[model samples]
Target: MNNIHLLDLIQGASGALDYVNSTVTGHHRRVGAGAAAIGGAMGLEGRDAADLVTAALLHDIGAFSLDLRLDGLDFEADHGDHARAGFRLLSVHPMLSRVAPLVLHHHTPWHRLPPLSDPGPGQADTPAAALLANIINLADRVDVLDQVGTRRVVRERIRQIISHNAGTVFAREAAEAFLDLSAGSEFWDKLSGDWTHVREAVDLPMADDLISHDQLLPFSRFFALIIDFRSRHTATHSLGVAETSARLAALAGMPPESQDRLRLAGNLHDIGKLAVPVTLLDKPGPLTQEEFEAVRLHAAASESILRSVPGLDDIADWASQHHERPDGSGYPHGLKRDALSLGSRIVGVCDVFTAITEDRPYRPGMTPDQSARVLRDMVGQGSLDADLVALLLDNHAEVAEARREAQARAHVEFERYRSLRVDGAAHAA
Candidate 1:
């Protein structure tokens, strides 16, 4: 496996979350950058800073998972439910577990914060975690501060708000760091302007410290949950495709390394769909032409999101090209048979097969024989690769069984997350 930067992966995931809602687009990036600046002002410049940035970038992930509407809401609006949900989501992964508690208490006011010696239940309760959460809380509010007039006026008003809330809504040290940093115009300029490249401004962990493929597979599974759990229609789509595609790739005699890439591609193939709203995804009827066109853009979006990471170019290509046809007629790109790789072809075939085989709100799932006939028809139309279609037909039982097993696991995960959301809401109420 190639070496990949952990910061790059976090940056890519931040971009993916932006697509969840247009109103909150770029929200995470701004918070991450601002939080890093605060960390630096407080004399944190190494792994501690990097971890703070990572927490900020993924702070809003639980909101995406819950399909919450954040548009037009105040910066300090009630978000405890989503914050708790985010804590639960990130606590499960080894790489993200340390940062999980920071996300949980990001919305907690400074006055409400528990003492380090007596931190409340489920809280990490360390001084470092508390400081990190406070930094993130202040940074998040800074990004969402209402701007109604000139830039200078808005900046001054935001500074006043932070200063006024010091020792109450904001931690004294964290608030002081932010105020000292914001006293100059450069900080405000960077915060309000193009800040997508802010990750480059800070010192992140070295590429050598990056996790290996084995470690990455679990993170990818966690990502699949974030992508698929938003809607019942897509609750198990990524897992089904991943399982079926890997099985088909093995049947085609591909090497194990190549098969692994195919499976990763399968898990991320529809990651761009995160940009599409749950309303559109779960619509029970046919999409209008405009909606269909909007849907087509997801393929290109997926490619753009994955391209940001340093390595895994092969996985990005295969995942993005799943929509391209063998003929020159497919969407996003009109690449013909010569341009598409075998891995891409395999993913394309499995994607279609999985969609037809899975039950949808609009229609029931088709039987294996029924889905096979549809795949064969597509092959006849020059849309799908005939050889890959043959692989599916010859091993229909095994392929179908793999898809079923994977989806079963995904369904259980989705239910668990659903229960968490409900419980969080009830507790908040």
Candidate 2:
């Protein structure tokens, strides 16, 4: 329950997740580790910086899929779901309540998203989380472009990725900073461009990262609680969504294994928002351009976080692709409908449904009718599939009932918390 305990839990959880995703996916891990190092070097306190490193390491914690065959994953889709899964699992744990939101919304963009800033000194740490998210973001690009601890080719290739993003994927500030970091020596090369020298440069976390599936899953579940702690409104949002979405997906005829992955993806769908400022998250007014820009980064943040794991690429792929629309309106990647899979598409709808139906600090949960109207509009706009919307509408009663059941569990938790409060008071006597 103390910060030290929480930190230990986080370290174990993150290290395990990092091992699985990195080993299985063959994407870089040290970039996240290195990014955390930069934050530590930049004067973040030991715990905070280490937490950042763990976050950096396991941010993509949702990307691994238990059922996914490893050969199908390239560097692209496998590790994407880690963020959402990671956030939801952490949200339920004690002491880690604060990190929950950052883990959830680290990919959150500024402006008109969940965790909109609220007016007050009592508002939580969304902004600080956002700052760390930004640091991780730039660090991710820097690591990829520098190829972190790898060869020069990978770094050069990273520049090509940045160039490709041009006006999208990254904002000018993010791009500019990344470009500056990309400059200088061979940091832009493959992860081992300086293999002989680099092996001796600094101790890497790889060995510690090696982990079994059983060890990794619980660790991931732990961080899910941390992500939910980011915002009062979103505390249980990811978990509920994942649970209900998986149930719905199965009811809608998805296979058991597919449903499992969907559940994982749904659990951490909003993992990136953890990095946004709480002020912005709870803000009641319209956001300035800067704030809005911050909101857009959440999905990308989610994607980067997931990439650090070992074998969870399938999970990451589906989860990270949720924000991406069929019409190429999504952030992180302007992936159009063709690029997205059936699982990813289902997640997109589930995320929208849960986000709107759930209470937000800024607005009331939309009525089913209201949520339906908006989703219908989205379908017409080519952002969503009209047929899928219709299917969801048909299943509205089931979805609502499921959500209510989940909410009831929270009421029980609330009562338990109240009981603890009373007990603690009596004990003080």
Candidate 3:
């Protein structure tokens, strides 16, 4: 296990979530900033503050997996199902299990909360968790409120809303802290202006336990779920790429560490695609120039999201460059042959291979021979790396087997997600 700042990873995940919908771009970050401010005002220090911010950033994670049309809905209107879904997702992870309940009750009103003294079955029902959840509830509501016109007018209106909900939607202490913090114009300015800076200002206590590459691999897989789970067409895309890339790296005789990094890069290469609309991604017909341009921006977005992590810089670079061509005809940053690293080249190859071999909305999966021809054609056009393509072709059976196995597992997960939606809908109806 390696010593890593867990907060940085959370921030990166938050960045990916921001891309899910451009309208809600900074929603998570703003909520996190507000929660941290409220936490500070309530005299929370060290780990308490850090945990609050972490929960806030991931508070809406369940929404990503949901089918809800969340474009303009207010916090109270959306209810608590997504909160329950998010709690279930986070609680499964060892590093994030502690904050699971905070997310679960983020939308729960203070009046409905169980008394802190008699928390229910789970530790998640404790006073600390409730306080953190209430703070997130207040912060999330604050971020979604209208902020049009003058700062003074906006602040006054927001303050009134917060005050009106006190002891009900908002815990009295959390509401009081936010009300006190809102009196200053700086608070409003930071919320509307540079929320990233505000979030960066607060330092989270470092984790004493370190995570190794083996342990960290599960985190990458989790992200793959977040990226591909949004639509059925792309459900197995990231996992296939991860498996294919690792297999290719092994065939190329790269060291074990390089192979692991390659697999991680493959899992994250499409992390930026979260920003592209699900409709756009699932469109069967050809895209408009504007839509294609939006699709192209994911590469750059992937880099921006992952670049901030401490030990993941190399992985970030490779993942971001997955779309770059050897001929400098690629998007985001059209780096030429020599400028691209070997790891980048391998990921680029695997990404294209996986896409061609996978079932897409408009097209069926290609046969191995068919995919080989397309890859060869790209190589001839000076786009793909010829040597890598040749190596992949030489080991076609092994590469295909790896991709099938990985994607088969992803298919099971996708079916499970679909089943949940069906059950939820049936229950609702």
Q: Top TM-score: which candidate number? A: 1
**Candidate 2 on 182-252: residue-level lDDT in tens?**
56653334333421222222233332334443343444444444455445667667766676667677767
- State the lDDT at 347 in candidate 2: 80
Answer with 1 or 2, whichever has the higher lDDT: 1
Quantify all predictions' global Cα lDDT against the true fold: 0.80, 0.55, 0.79
Query: 1 or 2: which has the higher TM-score?
Result: 1
Q: Rank the candidates by TM-score, best first.
A: 1, 3, 2
lDDT of 2: 0.55
> With candidate 2 superimposed using the best TM-score fit, by how many Å does residue 413's alpha carbon deviate from the native?
5.0
lDDT score, candidate 2, position 176: 55
Q: Locate the minimum summed-lDDT window of 10 residues in model 3.
A: 420-429
Using lDDT, give the best candidate's number. Answer: 1
lDDT of 1 by residue, 270-312 (tens): 8898888777877788999999888888899889888877797
Candidate 2 residue 46 C-alpha distance from true site, Å: 24
TM-score of each: 0.92, 0.52, 0.88
